[model samples]
Target: MKKERQATEGLVGLIPRAGALAARAGLDWFLLALIGMILLAWLFPELGVDREPLSLGDVANYGVSLIFFFYGLRLSPGKLKAGLSSWRLHLVVQLSTFVLFPLLILPLRSFFEGGEQELLWLGTFYLAALPSTVSSSVVMVSIAGGNIPAAIFNASISSLIGIFVTPLWMGLFLTSSSGAFDLGSVMGKLVLQVLLPVVLGIVLHRYWGVFAERNKKKLRIFDQVIILLIVFTSFCESFARDMFSGYSLLDLTALGAAMVGLFFLVYGITSAISRLLGFNREDRITAIFCGSKKSLVHGTVMSKVLFPDANIVGIILLPIMLYHALQLLASSVIAQATARKAGWEATGE
Candidate 1:
């Protein structure tokens, strides 16, 4: 069965173009852009916050739907069905994403029980609840000569599952922490803004899937623009409301350190789990890369829905943004090393 699975690994081709692009994305550029957004927000808060002449937030809300629509359009139903058959691989990746990550962080809640620090913990928890990213996960796995089919399957399926699981996990504390969390209203907005558009895109895929795929690089840029807009406006509100007042350089540095540690912890555990489950080299690589990533796209959009306060949202999104950047930095090096090691082994050096 293991050999049979290995034989069918080419169900999808390794996307070097995407891998190269993703590798560049994992570089410091995006992280610098994120920091630049914050600085811009700090300098010109009214630009994003003011709604008199225009509102970037409204534009972001519309963009969010379109992002998900393209997200769904790219999802090939036939491939999804095939991926479903690999129940064990899917189970490990999904569980590691939604379950193991959260469980690891849950223990530290005591250290940050209340105050501004509590919000940091909440942000960390939010990071844990998010689904794995689609592009980077698949890209890194592909670069490592992993199971491309399963990587695509797990990454795609994780996004769909996150639309539901993320909120449910968040609701556990969102309502209690802040009265702004109206689960019913929030989910309704997500259904219309996130879910419905995705369904529509999927239904229209046969007609437009090629378009979406052909223009995905363009669409991804669009996604990043919308996200930057969202981030800008969100922090604009945060700055206006003095959300980062309590957080100093040290505080942020500590949080950033924690985010790095969190990624390694999850990565280490998933690797161990893959070994214990007797996954093949390819399957093991897929599990480790896919299981250890989190979706910044979902985290950004969901923060708008989950935490209504722009002031609170800066803190809410802080952890994910940091984790996203750090994960990319760390994963790029790891992926390259893994690829090199594999090559060395294959060549019997």
Candidate 2:
């Protein structure tokens, strides 16, 4: 736990130095904020666990619906239609995200067969099962001079796809492990919370789309607020329940190292596949970047529904949060290097 606090402080202290780049990538400060939120939860568990100082958990639930609604608002049908021409690119990217990632992790399932390590492995698998993120993935691809249209399309489509696929992938384990998740029931609720809000927003896009786009930065802050609430509440429950009691620094180190390894493995595989497919420079960059990302937005909100056992939700989220930070740092450096080597400045266009 001390290790985490130290790490968190180090990350948070970098916020000032990264001000310019953070505007484009956004993950740098958000990563620090996440660590701060967790530390806050540790200091005052009652803020989340006791349902005091306002019902934040309930508010976060409402925020989830609004997040999707705004998501649908930004996604115009014409943009989606225009990006559909690259069928092969789409196929490889999506498979790399939803299929290839999970398959690579499945081989390690045997090592965590019924022990204290089971949940750790399950959390790692949860990270793999998540979708590519939106803003950051597009930003990274753009910085690297990648296929922007295809990146936007793949990232958007991946979120919608994970609305079904992520839960289904998780169901395979939940059904046997705890029997808490009713696939049919969860699907119904997801349609109401996730799908319905999205469809409604899409329907009203013509009317409110401009407003949403104009205030996108504010909307993104709203998303960040909601994510912070969820993280605080989740960690409050875990801390209150003593989930981290005996969790050693060595374990945290191992997990961090493992997440980095997982990232490289997926990234390497995607790069190889992109080369084999004879993709152009832009297309290859799009494939590798989009294929390697996992969305923390989807991870936290979906965990609200998927894992009802609030105490362990924090543990389930641990892998994604770490992966989120590492990916941003590594991707930013690589993106800058790629653009520099290509003799072009990253205009973030």
Candidate 3:
């Protein structure tokens, strides 16, 4: 027991520095965990407990509920108010998340027609429909010297809107492709799991808000731990259901290729738009980081709400898992490059 405790303590000790490194590197630990979960699903199919489908689903639902509850707890009304001051930047970020992504995804549907490919394409569309990441987007904006308040507001709002918009968009697109989706059921889950907790937090903001603000650091830790649990449970379900039975090396390669293409395409478009809009170096940095990201946290939560079945959930999350890794590696390199260029330009080197 002493040995086990020390080992656990050592791992906990590393989390702070590891989290700092992850932040500096422009990567999110949640994204890393999502990737790790996917690999675990592939490696150990029989590891997690075999529970009834509804029981597993209930666990997933509760996990998502707790996640958003903390999301609300951590949010400061003052910060949100301050962030809203930069309405123009917020509009741009929100529009890019909702409008630009859906338009881009529309044309790609035809590329995936049958078999697992169609499911993968649906996953891609789901990825595109989701919101920009919260922690990573804000971190990247900070690294690139963008408007921090605006980043916070836009990221938070994106997740909120995604609870509704993502499903609505999917229902419209996937109905013909995958039959009529249960819009009522999806909306009910979103309301209960996502929106209610947020509203509850906001209502109790007057009392708990100060406490939440004081313990922001601890709340963040709680959030990350909850996310890790969610990832583990989701992967366990996927493995138990044998959802990855037919997955192969070639399929992984193809998924990786698709993820790469999607990342570059979005990044290029956002970069060009920033340039065309005459945004300064800072705003451009913000645009590139914010516009290109899709949230793994939101994606995971929504997968449960939007795609309840184990196989569909597994497939829908695949591209998102791949994209999460690609974005981290790609964005880290790009941010570093941009930072170097900015330093040189400032120094007149």
How high is the CA lDDT of each candidate model? 0.88, 0.89, 0.78
| Candidate 1: tens digits of C-alpha lDDT, residues 94-201 | 999999998998889888897679989999999999999999998899888898889999999898888888888889776666656677888888889898988998
Give me the runs in candidate 2 sitting further than 4 Å from their true place: 1-27, 344-349
TM-scores, all models, native as reference: 0.91, 0.91, 0.84
Q: Rank the candidates by lDDT, best first.
A: 2, 1, 3
Which candidate do you rate higher for TM-score, 1 or 3? 1
Lowest-scoring 10 consecutive residues by lDDT in candidate 1? 10-19
Please write out the lDDT profile of model 3 over residues 1-349, one tens digit for every residue.
9999999999999999988887766466566666686677567645534554445445656767777876787777788888876665667777888888878877977777766577778888888898999887887777667777777878888889888899899898867767868888989979988899988887777878788879777877766665655566667767777776667889879889978988898888888877888887777777778888998888878777677665557777778878887888788877777778878898999
Winning candidate number (lDDT): 2
lDDT (10s digit) by residue, model 2, range 300-342: 9888988888999888899999999888877888888888878
Q: Clashing residue pairs, candidate 3?
A: none
Error of 2 at 244 (Å): 0.9
